[model samples]
Target: MTGGGWRRTLPLMPASIPSASRENKKKIPYAWELVGWLWLAYFMNQADRQLYSVVQKQVQEALGLTDIQTGLVNTVLIAAMAVMMPIAGFLGDRLSRRRIILWSLLAWSVATMLTGFTGGLVSLIVIRSLATAVGEAFFVPAATALIGQYHVKTRGQALAFYQTAQYFGAVSCGAAGGWIAGQYGWKHSFWLFGGVGVVLVALMWRRLKDAPKTAAAIACSEPIGDVLRALFRTPTALVLTLALGCSTFVNMGCLAWAPTYLQLEPFNLTPARAGFFSMFYYQLFSFAGVLLGGRVSDKIVGRRPAFRVELSGVSLLLCVPTLYLMGATSTLWVVYAMLGAFGFFRGLYDSNIYASLFDVTAPRYHSSATGLMVGFSFAVGSLAPLALGAIKQSYALHTGISLLGVVYIIGSLALFIAARGFFPSDFLRNQQTVPTSPKL
Candidate 1:
């Protein structure tokens, strides 16, 4: 494979399988099947994360926890994920990605189930923050890299399809958790989601198989320092990392507070209504944006490789006004409109993020690159919930939320810089590194 054309054959094969069987397997559309299974895992991953935010009020009242303490729960979880991401990325390159993903699903599900048993902040931090974070940190980089191996020509569309699970999970869990809390208790929501995750893990264990490693894959397993150096040397990757951090700051803050915000002010919604409204419009439009963005980018990217990055930059820039308006406005209808617009643009950016990064980095470095980008972004984002919590103490929550538009401005600018000045050279360098042997 090179810059001029896509590969006609699979890039990697299972070592244990014979050449005949490998070719037979390639004829089947198992890539989509992989996407299906991982979609379920990713759905559970997101739904579990959003449950705390959806039921924040109930949890806070039940445990006598203050705003800062509740904010600390999300902050610590992101922090732990950030700390573990690089190690997980390293392992993804060397070990069985299938095993890593399966184990991660099991570990996090168990921790989420145990969360129903927590009595106070300490146990919450231990189960929800540390244990769950450790589990989830292993899933994304490995899963994404695995997908990249399977679908080179349709990478953007496949990832975009996979990405929709995030919006669905957040929206569904937010609404369901709120209703469950109202009907029964916050604890049942946890147990229900966790049990579902465990079932998915068992199914995946039975069905998921690792891609056979190619000689190139085995040969390119560099030391951790080398992997880090390879990624940092690419200017576009660095800018993308910073861009991710900025966007994450806004996203994490909104996810943590938006439901509670709706429940309190001019909106004056019930808990279930607040949770549904907070997620429904934003994610629904976001779902549309990702699919459209993916199909457009895939159609044009062969001729305009940097189009993915450019699309991300443009989408982030477009989202700025809507994000600001969503927070500044008090009218419920206006807020919903802004949320939909903001989410659509966010989906456009999210659709191409990993695809854009993969375009600039060697295939061997995909997991490590994803890990570095995600870890740095999460570290930066971990401050958002805590910062918003502190800001709520001094001013209206909307004020803090409105100010997040500034971070988007900075991120969009960085992405524009990356697209224009650095992407061409970095992309060419990556294309040169990809092994062209037919056996691969």
Candidate 2:
């Protein structure tokens, strides 16, 4: 359908649509440039997040912390992010997203540097958890929404490229952080990564620009309550949020503990080796999967939007066995193989996450919906680390990890339902309500 046809179908369509769409079409080069900068920012974001996990043992020994205390550090940070994301999302719609992105980068970079000075659990919670979380929380809703505005046809590919930073950052930090902590102490690792982030902020300040928004766009901004209500009312969005939560739960638990797990008994690997191996194989395969999944989804989604959600569902289903086997196996090689498989499936789902979400949501509410989806997911995910720590005290770490497969089962089922029962109507409504742009 034509753009005018779409606008006519929805009485509430914002008047800013045509001008905004035209501006996006003309700025395609700048859009890719924007992704290039955001890529580096996101790399640092994931790297900072994984730094403590890679050096967990060293930090624990230095601070005299137990397993649960270590777990609480990650839990607190994620919980803080959960609490702040909705507010950030709301602001992203009304405020200048460029400023929000830059300020968030500055705040988090400063927090990361200060994390090196933490003396105990309280200080860690204060700097790493609360301070960093607040900054990081503002980033994604703005960044992703901004990207969505610039690249309509290539949304999956653009986002997939962006998502690769998460894997690369985690892997780099896991390997480098362990070596740094092992040789120079964990404090030095934090200082190094944090400094890089600070420098990056200074460099990106003048380059990034927000999508053009007219007076009508500003006038039509929805309240937080209305945004929340709209997101929850969309069945596909609700299902996608639940799926994200399930995957995040597994990811948080595993990323936080896998390095430590490999250091124990049968593996008996050095901290550096453990960190490298735990992240390397999985993320390597995930890198490949995301690239392939993104290309495939973008090609097919024009004719079959439901296939995007279906792909995510199928990927999660494939992940169940691999996830279980990765935790259950005692053999190092088998564990590595399972990790690779699990990561590949995870990449498939990750590649289309926001692309799929955007399919069912109107353009105006993209940031708010992203915030609601991510906030709820993180809130659900925040319990993983704490729950695993308790399980470690009561049973075994591997046992807890194996049980995460059940979460994936629930998640896959939810996505399948959304794909089969809800996505068709939701996608159709979205296309009808928003100005039709290039196909994703």
TM-scores, one per candidate: 0.94, 0.92
Off by over 4 Å in 2: 1-28, 214-220, 436-440
TM-score computed on alpha carbons, candidate 2 = 0.92
Tell me the lDDT of candidate 1: 0.87
User: How badly does each model clash, as a count of residue pairs?
Assistant: 2, 0
Shift of residue 311 alpha carbon in model 2, Å: 0.5
Q: What is the Å distance of residue 335 in model 1 from its true position? A: 1.1
Model 1, clash count? 2
Among the numbered candidates, top lDDT falls to 1
Q: Which tens-of-lDDT digit does each residue in 58-151 have in candidate 1?
A: 9999999998999999999999999999888888888889999999999999998999899899999999999999999999999998888777
RMSD to the true structure for each prediction, in A, is: 3.0, 4.0
